[model samples]
Target: MSSQTLNKIPLISLVGPPNSGKTTLFNYLSGKKFKTVNYPGSTVEYSISKILSKHAVNADILDSPGIISLIPSSPDEQLSVNTLYSHPKFGKPDIVAVTVDVSQLSRHLYLVKQLLESNFKVVVVLTMTDVLYKKGFDISENKLSSILNCKVVRVNGKTGKGIDSLLTVLKESLNEIEKDSAASLIKADKHHKTKLLESYSEIEKIEKEVLFETDQKSTNGKIDIQKINESIVVLNSAPKFLKADETSLKIDKFILHKFWGLIIFFLIMALTFTSIFWLAAPLMDLVNDGFSFLSENAFTLLGEGLIADLIANGLISGLGSVLVFLPQILILFLILGLLEDSGYLARGAMLIDKPLSKIGLNGKSFVPLLSGFACAIPAMMATRTITNKRERFLTIFIIPLMSCSARLPVYALLIAFLIPQETPWIGGLLLAAIYVFSITSSIIIAAIVNKFSNRLVKEKDNTSFILELPAYRMPKPMRVIQETIKNGKQYVVKAGPVILFLSLLIWILTTFPNYDPVVPVSPDVSPEQTEILKSNERMSTSYAAYLGKFIEPVMAPLGLDWRVGVSLIATFAAREVFVSSMALIFKITEEGDDMQNSILNSMREAKIGDSDQKLFTTATTAGLIVFFVFALQCLSTVAIAKKETGSWRIPVLQVVVFTALAYVFAFVTVNGLRAFGVN
Candidate 1:
């Protein structure tokens, strides 16, 4: 065959097993920083981008999902394997870059051998060499490359070590493929039909060949060790990163113990959840102050007209309320990201797997469930990583009960009134109790749903959990901050507009029919008192109040009145709006520390309709807390569920089922508590 330069740009496909740092390498080559998740199936779809590394030849690179073999075991694996062939849009790949984790070199090379036999140009990229080396095992790149009949390069994706060398090899491979472009493209067009090597003993033999010990003793390719050592590695790679890994091994030992592990996991979770409250308070206040400043400026600039009031109260305040959650969102993901990068999260998943399995989910569902504590929108997106459709749908269905950060304000406000401020620990304890109750209820409900769903729908769900833990490494501060900021932006982008529109709608609903900008106030009162009275009068006569009165009878069963009905309606757009709606109901514009105290005082003094008794009774507040825990209040979550499931039936079912459950549980709680004479 005559050699010729191709007219089209060369294509390269990146393939690797999960947690092999493949996405990190892809980010380097493509000049695109896609999130590198530590768990499997995060890269559920392929990402294509232009080759931007100066050392590499100009080409288009496709980063595919992690796969163990050419023969697919799951949907995501099939997507990865399919891209090795020539595509109508992608053309033929000049080279397939297989990222081989040196720690598990032998197993990774099986895929390399398969590609080599298929007559495709394959380059074995040795990553995590340091990870293996720290475990006292090192590889001979020349020895391994000679056996595989392909060029091999070791690269550190995080440090940019050996990346240029790897890129140069890709350049050479691209040139070699160009020599026989026509024939190569023809070969690439056909799919891989026969299965690849499946023999474990054969792989183990090869594992022994190229691996050596730093201290002159080697476990070879697979890290075989004493029972304790094997247990250490199994938990997460207990690398000899000095005495630190030794400490990790000891700590992991205790954490994996049957009794201590539960205590440890709960402590870790409590720390994570509590950080969302205390750690985010100062930053949340800053965000609130920032928005309040903007709202004031908007009102000042436009003067006291409907437009100014709408822009300030409806638009700015609306966005401010939802966006105030940005700090908590960032903090939550930051802590979780650090935990993931440190390898502890893998153990956390494993620890939780037993209970989850009882409810028909595996460790894979933990990430999404944990993420739901931040927001259901991203939590729902995280479900894509779950390969099983049923598990993903079920995870999404139960996510609302996780009590996301959106409900934090509602909880904080209600808890403030429910528990006296003088006894702060009681409030804290009660708050913690609510979260505990919610999580427990979710587990129970999930088990019930799983049982009933199995009877109604018969689908083959035989997929078992396969988790490969990465070596524990110190989390990079930059990576944690970057991921947190990325997720914060996503939260804002997803929920911002929805909040804005609904805020405008709610303002309109509470302002009109008569549409009066001003209401009569007592001339003898102070300015603040006059403004408060006018605000109260305006709300009392507004269209929202009329609707609230209409729905009051339905809500009364749970001991809630017209005001709570209006607030609940407002939160449907975004759950965080419940706080803002409550603030409006109480004649407050913001939920900062100073204003929160004022709102609490107002709520304490509040009466139901013409009655002299308090409205926010302890029993009613407890019922409200329980209601928020189970209710599908966030429409954004519903929309995302619709998007992920591709069915209206599921999302509708989620809303109906959760709302009914919330009503029932809340009614029971309120009545039950009153029967116990707690109030």
Candidate 2:
């Protein structure tokens, strides 16, 4: 092969087990700041960046989703495995870079062995050498390299230590392969029929040759023990000597204590909810005022016409309803990112493992379930860590019930309206209660699903939960802030367009058919009342009102009128759109009033037909909260669920089952509360 042909844009892939600092190395090599965290399954999707290495020009580096083995299990693992050979878009990578945690060498080497057997040009990057030294194990890269017949480089991904040497080794290895093209081609040909049993035997041989126990207490204290491939081995000075850091052990003792841990967990969660309200309040108010100003000024400039209504009522007011909650969304992710980056999230998962197992999941499932509170899309993707197919699907099924941040706008709006802001503590407690209720409901539903799924699928449960708790470290503030902003931006990018489209559709539906009121304009009636009457007359014959009436029969049982029914339909696009839809509808009804004032006052004063009874009573608000909690309203979530599961049936079933549960629970809650004289 010619040098020119061998130098064709080199593609390098980074692959590793979860939380092994694979992405950190990718950032170092590519000089890009992709998000990294202490927990597993953080990289739900792959990232590609142009490599900036001096030795390797025109190189494109791909950071694939983390995987435990080449034998694919979850969607993420499958993607990683597929990327190694012939990715449809990325093509086959010229070289594979495997990151192995030296502290957990025995476990990490399993994937490396598989990669070697597959005949790919592989380089093993040993991460966490300092961590390995802390654990009292000294690893020799040269020894491991000789045993595995591959190049090994040790580097600290965070500090950029030894990165230049690794790149140099990669360039040397590529040149060596190019020189021995005939042998390389021959080795590639043999990989097609590589035997797994043979590979496993070779891995066992390599493990014995390169790994050793360090003990100083007794004569010949390093005596060999039975080979344990599944569990991690912690080297110590003696058989009984504890290897864990004293500080971490002490912290875990209190934080992982069952009773205390549960209490502390709830307290932390309560604080998080409280902070969302307290921290985001001023920013939310600013956003609200800004949008209100835009709406008023645009109305004045455009004058009374469809264009003004479109710009002010349809666009500004609708977008404002969702935008006002962006600060809260940012805060939620910021808090979660801190928890995850501090390595406490894994300990929390460990604390909840027993309870989760009773519901047919384990600590691994808890991370994804916890993430569902931020967003179900990524939460669903985070289930890639659950190797068991049954447990992964079950976790995905209940994630939407966890009350994601998208529901924050609706919850905050309704809760504020329902409970006075003067009693903020009460509102905060109510908000926390909603989250607690969501978790409790998810557990119950998961338990029910587990019972039935066992009878339906009948697969043996061979997968065991094994969680590796990372060393505690301070979270990088810049990274956390960047990730939080990225998440908030994603919400805008994904839901913004849909909300704008729906707002316009709703505006048109309520605006047209040109119904001039048959009754003469009474001189005694105020202009606001006249506009309200005109709106009522027009909406009575408009398409949106027709949709509302069509769905009202179903919604009326939950104490919602046709207007609320219209908003509910719009929520199918996104849970937050419920607020925006209501804002637009109410703004259209009461013209010439401040948009903010019109929405709040209109909702408060709204009443049922032929009666003065308010529509948004305590019972109605509670029902709506319950409905939003259970309903799988986000279309993006459904699409992702379908894509992940590779079947439309699961997504369809999710929607049908969750929507029905929402309606039934809402109906029962509303009627039951009213019957108890709570309304």
Candidate 3:
């Protein structure tokens, strides 16, 4: 078999245990911006991209979910294993590029051995070698390669060190695999059916051949620490006795202290939320100004017809309402990514585990819950790490309460209208307080659910909390920027088209059934006032107003008028649609040549029916925020929930319960504020 005889695009799989820098390597090789986190189970699905190699052979590379072994313990692990041998979409890979963390060679070798024994073409790429070397333990890649009878190359995914060498080695290994008919060097028949004990025995034999250490201990008549150390040859410069990681230990002393850790976590989260407003303000202003310029030009060029209105008001203003918040979204992801890459996020999980376990979830659930702030979809997917069915279900059920980035646009709109700009810090504090309220509400709901659900399903006490805290290193700036841009672009790509269409739809619905104003014109009435009256009269008779009126009775208790009701109905598609819908509705209602007149001003001036009072009172704004915080309005989330749960019942139940709760809370908030004379 020659290279030309095989397929043109060779499939290369980068497989490794969790947090072995496999994703970083994948990103480097493929020139793609997949997320890289310092925690386990981050890569839940396989990402396939073309390898940007200068070699003659072009390859399609896959970064699979991290697995400890072929036998799966969780859904992510199962997916990874299935992709390796029997994926429904992508069949088994041609070559398995095993990424080995040099610091944890003994544990990682077990998977390498399994791959070799299973007759998979394997090439070992050693990562974290520098970390291992810094800790006074360095193993020769050549010697390790000779012992394993495979091609081994050292590479740093972050710095691109040794990547060229690894590519050269990969080319040779691929050629060798082609010559050998894509077979493993060591041929063993029926190795896939090898017993667990036999596999361990085989792994032990290899471990003893390469590692070296002093004063190792054995437990339960199993392979001893001495044998594990003897599997790798330690460099002569290595310390005679391994020392504890003093810096991490000292930091952990305070960071993991029960009281201090909790306080620090809250402070960090508060800063993160506050920064979303303070830091993103300038960029948001720029985006707003940019859209304003574009809208003005469109209106000037196209003139005052339907096309001009559609482009300038419907599309530009509507999309801009959502796009201005992109800066905030990027900042949020950047801060979270820094925390994750620095290994502080895992510690935060550890600190919160005890309280979470009390509510029937372990520390593993914390990652998904934290991820909910970005979006509920991936957070729900991340719940696959929870092996306990009941815990996993509970995590999924409560995820939507965390107030994802979709809600950020709505929050920013309402907060800007409600909170004054002069008091920037006050606005930031309000933003932080919203997130705090969301978390508090989620915990209360979880507690109530845990209390009742435990009686129905027997609580499992065997589930343990085991977390790995990677060495805290400076976050790669380029990586942070890449992820920020990638995520921000995703928001635009996913939400932009839907929002534009809905905006256009809303414009049509509000513009039709145009009525001739019969009201007598007065000389005192300005043209702007006349235009406002005509627009309001037209909207009152329009199709959108009819639908809003139909729902107005139901929403009246929450201080929302028919216009707000219309936007709320549109938000069922996505929370961010609320902003665009409002933008379109207000654009039609207000008489302004400038599309840049803050939507906040129009909202403030908006009146409810014949009332002289403003529609967006403090009470109304507060109530809207409450409703959005609790409502499961996203149809995509509902669909994903149904798919993940394998039934419509759970998703339906969530929708009903959350919507009812949102109504009740919103009613209370508005009425309570009104009672306190907060107009």
lDDT of candidate 2 at residue 464, scale 0 to 100: 73
Distance from true location, Cα of 378 in model 3, Å: 2.6
In angstroms, the error of model 2 at 441 is 2.3
Write the number of the candidate with greater TM-score, choosing between 1 and 2.
2
Write one digit per residue (lDDT tens) for candidate 1, span 1-679.
2211342777788988877888778877866444332222256567788788565478878887888766666556766777766544675567889999887776677777667767777899999887676666688888878877789998986798998898889888877765754344323223333432344445555566677657423445554557436545543432221222354677777878889989999999989998887898678778776877787677679976679878877887788787878788888889888887778787888888787888877677898898888888767766665666667677877888897888877787788787766897787788778889999999998888888766523567774777766666788777567657767775677688888778778878776764554755566778766666667778888889999999999988887789989989888767888866666667654334354666777788889888886788889989998888888998778887898777787789888999999889999999999999976
Lowest-sum lDDT 10-residue window in model 2: 229-238
Worst 10 residues of 3 by lDDT: 233-242
- lDDT string, candidate 3, 404-508, tens digits: 877876887788878776886676678778988988998999889888766534656557766677666787788777766776776677667876677777878
TM-score of each: 0.83, 0.84, 0.86
Best by TM-score: 3
Root-mean-square deviation of every model? 6.1, 5.8, 6.0
lDDT of each: 0.75, 0.75, 0.76
Clashing pairs in 2: none
